[model samples]
Target: MMRVKNFAHSTFATTNHQTMADAQALLQKADKKAASGGGGGFSRFFGGGTTNYEDAAELYIQAANAFKLQRMSKEAGQSFEKAAAMQLKTDEKDDAPNTLVEAYKVYRKTDPEDAARVMESAIQMYTAKGNFRRAATNKSDLAGLYELELSDIPKALEAYDVAGEWFSGDQAEALANKAWLKVGELAALQEDYARAIARFEDVARSSVSNNLTRYSVKEYFFKAGLCHIASGDLVATKRAFDTYLNLDPGFMSTREFELLQDIVTAIESADQELFTEKVFGYDQLSKLDKWKTTLLLKIKNGIEDEPDLT
Candidate 1:
């Protein structure tokens, strides 16, 4: 029995563990009936034209909880398994068991190999119900996990490709999510920023009046500018910064923004000697590369987005 945990003062939160225990007990009882030799597992538990879906699902929910707590992953997976079966019989399609996700989460944590085996089961459940898209989606997430957590980049790329086929172009939020994740991942890995900048730029362009337009173009310009700086295109970098500051004249923390404004002033004035000290040589930017690149990117993201205090 789980002590009731406070949920925002509503105070009626039972742990998932309790649910799992009840479910396990139900499965055991059903198993016993099947073992008596008269009925096969499927018919005795889910068949016989005797539909008590409400009871079956309730049992499953409890089992899910128990499996989660006791870490009986296989049992928990089966619990959601049983619940999904019950739902189908009752035509309670809306009651599609969420147990698959629950089971997958647990199974992945301890036994990843088993988790892959279980994900197939989840796909089976969704496919049986004629939900092809959901099956595909779950499969994609599963593959992504393998790629990211398991370090299977090729497999991960495959998953991402399949997910792309899920018509994400029509779904702004989902597309944005994938794009954001890719860009951030590449940046952290320091993989070529050119591709990342392109991804971010796509997001910025698409956001113009729909999903992305919420943030100003100044942000996009800043991002693109940093990419230019990284690729050693000083000329383009200045152009990006120029656009960024022009969009928000009083933008940035006073000192940094002023520094940038000074750079612009110097560059425009054609002060070769003064600007030489501020900028870097591509060949010369070795050990301290990331910091210099980061400083440039930060200058763009912050200055353009921040309001002018000066």
Candidate 2:
């Protein structure tokens, strides 16, 4: 809690609104003094009775939080940005980047556009400082905002690709794989199976080469095979499985591999009903929800073009 300053034996406003008003007044006075390049009274009231950019930044942050208590997100975000700028100006390098991220989060709660702008600012700051890891992380967040908040798939994919590049440059292979996985998902959402499979294949290979989680490699290959099958490329599906076994030879005996083999056999026999029945009867496959069943049906639809009662 901020203690009310006693001036001339008059207690400063103790109410939240009054306190906020006083803080803003101080902020404005400081701004005026800052504009004229003259240290002002606001500086004297800050911690240690010394007015400086760093102290002004803290004051702005306090005012911003007071505004936030009243549900004023935009003002709060603006105040945080000011704090970040002042932190940078004071050569407080370590805290500057994350302060901007804090502002971006506040903006994201009420204004996605402003959130993206703030993130871009943070990215630029991080990049200029050669902090590629943080830049890549922020780029990934920006990509998510584009996808989920802005509903712009192309921009989201572009953002992910750029983030992946930065992560790769930073030798953060796991993070790079995550970005590429998202890119692959977006490609699949767009029904660009070839592109999706290609990205999935790339990530899967990288995961194996980097010796990341072993199970994920099989999952990636399975997803790629699904895409190949959905796109009516049985030969590609066979090759995908072959590649998977070669990479993790032990996976060849897993139920997932058996399921793949059964699926391939069903496709080769051109027996859509048999494929559906075999898939539904498999105990492990029963775990697959309806959407996946629908995708498998799409692959079955490719196997045979016919209109008849099941």
- Report how far off residue 171 is in candidate 1 (Å): 3.6
Q: Which regions in candidate 2 have their CA more than 4 angstroms from the true location?
A: 1-16, 38-56, 85-96, 209-212, 265-270, 282-286, 289-310
Score every model by TM-score: 0.50, 0.76
Model 1: per-residue lDDT, tens digit, 42-95?
Answer: 864755333445456656666566666666777776677666656555656555
lDDT of each: 0.55, 0.76
Number of backbone clashes in candidate 2:
1
Writing each residue's lDDT as its tens digit, candidate 2 over 1-310 gives 1334454235433465676686577567545433433244665445223236666677667767776766677887888887776776564766777877888888886888888888898898899989999999999999999999999899899899889989999998889989988888787767788888888888888877654467688777766777777777777788878888888787787766777788888777777877877677764544875545656767777768744434
* Span of 10 residues, lowest total lDDT, candidate 1: 279-288
Q: How far off is residue 297 in model 2, in Å?
A: 5.3
Q: Candidate 2: lDDT over CA atoms?
A: 0.76
Query: After best superposition, candidate 2 residue 253: deviation in angstroms?
Result: 1.7
